[model samples]
Target: MPDVTTSVRRRAFLLWAVAALAYAVDLGTKLAVVAKLEGRTTVSVLGDWLVLRVQRNPGAAFGMGAATTIVFTLVATAVVVVVIRYSRRLASAPWAVAFGLLLGGALGNLTDRVFRAPGDFQGAVVDFIAVRDFSVMNLADWAITGGCALALLLSFRSSPMTGTAGASDAGAPGAREA
Candidate 1:
């Protein structure tokens, strides 16, 4: 078996690598969209199913909480801090990947909130990816959404209610065995 320290280091590396990749893609796409799509009409990529349109969102996902840009920035900062703190105890590879995606997504938007137009910590996030019948969003938004879904799946898989292996039910008040 791999030593605990080695395992942790490996997990940490995976987390950072995934986070970096996600962040890079998010930032790169935002830059490209801004450079190529700003001040222009939407460009269809999939027969109106998907299109590129430039927008600056000063709120959370789906254009909600537009007036709370500062609050969102602070929350994103807290998430990054929490992820870093929890990373030290990450023994599960899936959890590491989930947290990495969350971190990257959070940082990608946080970067805009801190450095983009309007002002510091109150700047708007650039969003472009638009679906015909859904909300317009960006790579970071997709990363965050995907990360949350993965994390929820992992949580369910590790829950005792799911009868996952190694999930102990011995401490339950009305425990029974098959």
Candidate 2:
């Protein structure tokens, strides 16, 4: 059997590694979009089905709650705190990745909120990717959306966040023998 300490460390490492990678990618892409496309006309990548148009959003996805940028910032900060505080107990690789994505995405948007424009903690997030009849978004948005979906799936599967086994092996071959 693997040592508990070693297992915990491995999970923690995975979580941090994923978080760092997501954060880096989100930051890099956002910066590139801002520098290259902020003032230019929309660049079509695949007709009108997909395009890149720089937009600074002070609201949540789909540009909702434009008047509550500070609230979003606070909520994102809370997510970061909760994820970091609960990471020590992670045992499942999927859960770790989910939380890591959540953390990294939160931090990515949070950085924009803190430093972008319109003052600290009320700054707009840079969004560039747009789909037909859909709101503009970014990599951070994708990460957060994916993380939430994965977490919900794991929860439905009754996967344990801190255990040697996940759900059960009841349906496995020879899981039960006479």
Candidate 3:
């Protein structure tokens, strides 16, 4: 069996560190954009395929949840706390990374919502990396999406059938599918 105590620490630290790194990058880029562009400049790349267009988001993925920053922030904070508290339950690196990416993205956006806006607790998230006809996103957002995708891939790597003594335990009353 894996060392549950050590695994717990590994998961928590890794997740928080990943999140912190992501938040730093996200905040730094947004600061640069705000200082240099102030939402007035656009740098085109790939012939209109991509552009650095500054935008503020107060919502969820793809610009959803604009009306609920307070609620969302609280939920995000709760998620971080829960994940950190339950890190021991994490069984793999992919899960650890996924949790970290999500935590970092949430905290990154939450920082904006808490301190960069028209009012307290109503700040807007900085989103760049505009895609024509699609929505604009930032690094934090990408990290969360990418991390979740990677986690999903990892989950597939060890389905229940491939689990420890899976076949031997398959006949058990509590056996589960992968």
**Candidate 3 CA-lDDT value:** 0.73
TM-scores of the candidates are 0.88, 0.90, 0.78
What RMSD, rounded to one decimal, does every model reach?
3.9, 4.7, 4.0
Best by lDDT: 2
* Model 3 lDDT tens row, 1-178: 6555665566667777887888798789888988887648788877798999888888876788899877767876787687666555554556777777877777777778788876578877888889988889888788778777876776676422122321245565546554
lDDT of 1 by residue, 43-146 (tens): 98998999999999999978999999999999999999988987766757787888899999999999999999898799999999999889899998899998
TM-score, model 2 to reference: 0.90
Stretches of candidate 2 exceeding 4 Å from the true structure: 163-178
Clashes of 1: 0
- Report the C-alpha displacement of residue 10, candidate 1, in angstroms: 0.4
Better candidate by lDDT, 1 or 3: 1
Per-residue lDDT over 126-170 for candidate 2, one digit per residue giving the tens place of the 0 to 100 score: 999999998799999999999999999988876666544333446
Q: After superposition, how far is residue 45 of candidate 2 from its true place, in Å?
A: 1.7
- Location of the lowest summed lDDT over 10 successive residues in candidate 3: 159-168
Candidate 1 Cα errors over 4 Å, as ranges = 159-178
Question: Which candidate ranks first by TM-score, i.e. highest?
Answer: 2
TM-score of 1: 0.88
Write out the backbone clash pairs for model 3.
Answer: 19-104, 60-64, 160-178
